[model samples]
Target: MTEPVDEGLVIYWRPLCGFCQRLLEALEVAGIQATLRNIWDDPEAATFVRSVNDGAETVPTVVVDGIVYTNPPPDQLVIHLQQA
Candidate 1:
């Protein structure tokens, strides 16, 4: 898959992460468009997540307009989406 573009939300996640699922569902419910990148499936994505997460692979890492947020609450994400 291609690297995420700079214009929209990009979520770095992993399988079996409840938080990731929750965030995805919330985004859908809120009618927000975001690109979902599974860390397990993309080595570059995993590395990016690690770079911001103290060298650990953390799920629900979100990038929006070049800003990074780790495990943000759904409401917080919605606010950011609206701002964008």
Candidate 2:
């Protein structure tokens, strides 16, 4: 029997957020595959994002499995995901 592998990280952000754009660009440069969820398009996602950060609608919030990162920088996020 094989253990189930995690499906990588999920990033919740908005298209117009500069920080989100930076994070995306960095992820692209690092060749990382992250599930990008735009909160603006999905109300549930927006609500979820807010829930993760005490009702703060901060973009570039990423969830690695259940671990939440509220607006973490690109490099920091890279290291964090790698360790996960």
Candidate 3:
């Protein structure tokens, strides 16, 4: 059987994206601390982000441990964090 993805609460976001802004706000309100990687500052990261999402660099993609949450909501994200 295939093992489940274990994404561990790391968020990749862009400054211009409103969804990213909301996600950050939600994290703050929920008192959650997540490592954020901005694609603009790091060119290599932009490439890596694309690789993670099948060549589509989607903002607000979160990695909780190994699994990826492509645009996860705040409540769902909290639940995921609780699992860790």
Candidate 4:
């Protein structure tokens, strides 16, 4: 079994996705630490994203404190981070 990531946000994304890039930049600007998992590089990350998104490999799939968010806006993500 794979070891769980117990801290920080896990970001499942693709390299060419503009939204993914934007979100990463926003997280950086907000000083939020995130673990970036490129879907194209990691099959497990892609599978996890697909599992959350109706079997579709959706980019910008973020996991925060065990909650999944698909394409969430930067402000919303920051809110969640703040709450955490």
Candidate 5:
């Protein structure tokens, strides 16, 4: 995972999650670097995810340019990352 960048790409996820794994893999394949935050390990990240997802600790909660995108499609996320 890449280091966190100011107002850049950030993904809040967790282990044993198929959606998270697939999304991360797709981003890597698409050459889109991002900061990964594991909700299990980071309390603040977990809270943030819950806040965005209506109290669910949803994996693959992505943040780009300060805008939250919950469970975004892989291809769309890649395009958004490239554009940002």
Candidate 6:
């Protein structure tokens, strides 16, 4: 909700999204630094999520180095982070 990121990892989420919470927790445990964008709070963020999800507002959408991932598994996200 603060600012959108252009590099590294950006996690688009909503506060009430369970999957988002889970992913955030996983990132924390993995010591991954990611910019968090709350889609519910930012209309542009929601639109971005929709664009990447076939026009559906899917929370926990992750972007790394401009690459978008829709609801990636926690372990897979970690792997992506490592690759980033």
Give the top-scoring candidate (TM-score). 1
- Ten-residue stretch with the least lDDT total in model 3: 1-10
For model 6, name the residue pairs that clash: none
lDDT of each: 0.86, 0.79, 0.76, 0.83, 0.84, 0.85
Give the per-residue lDDT digits (tens) of candidate 1, residues 1-84. Answer: 234447578999999999999999989998998888899998889888888889988889998988889999988889778876
Worst 10 residues of 6 by lDDT: 1-10
Ranking by TM-score: 1, 4, 6, 5, 2, 3
Q: Poorest 10 consecutive residues of model 5 by lDDT?
A: 1-10
Candidate 5 residue lDDT tens string, 1-84: 223335588989999999999899999998888888899999888888887788998889998887788898988888877776
List the candidates' TM-scores in order: 0.89, 0.84, 0.80, 0.88, 0.87, 0.88
Which residue pairs come into collision in candidate 1?
Answer: none
lDDT of 3: 0.76
lDDT of 6 by residue, 1-84 (tens): 323469678999998889998999999999998888888888889888887788898878998887788888998889867876
Please give the distance, in angstroms, between residue 47's alpha carbon in candidate 6 and its true position after superposition: 1.0
Error of 3 at 40 (Å): 1.0
* Candidate 6 vs. true structure, TM-score: 0.88
What is the C-alpha lDDT profile of model 4 across 1-84, one tens digit per residue? 233255658988998899999899989988898888998999888878887889898889888877788999988888778787
Model 6 regions more than 4 Å off: 1-5
Rank by lDDT (best first): 1, 6, 5, 4, 2, 3
Writing each residue's lDDT as its tens digit, candidate 3 over 1-84 gives: 222224446778888899899888988887888888887886665776787778887988887767777888877787767666
In angstroms, the error of model 2 at 10 is 0.3
How many pairs of residues collide in model 2? 0
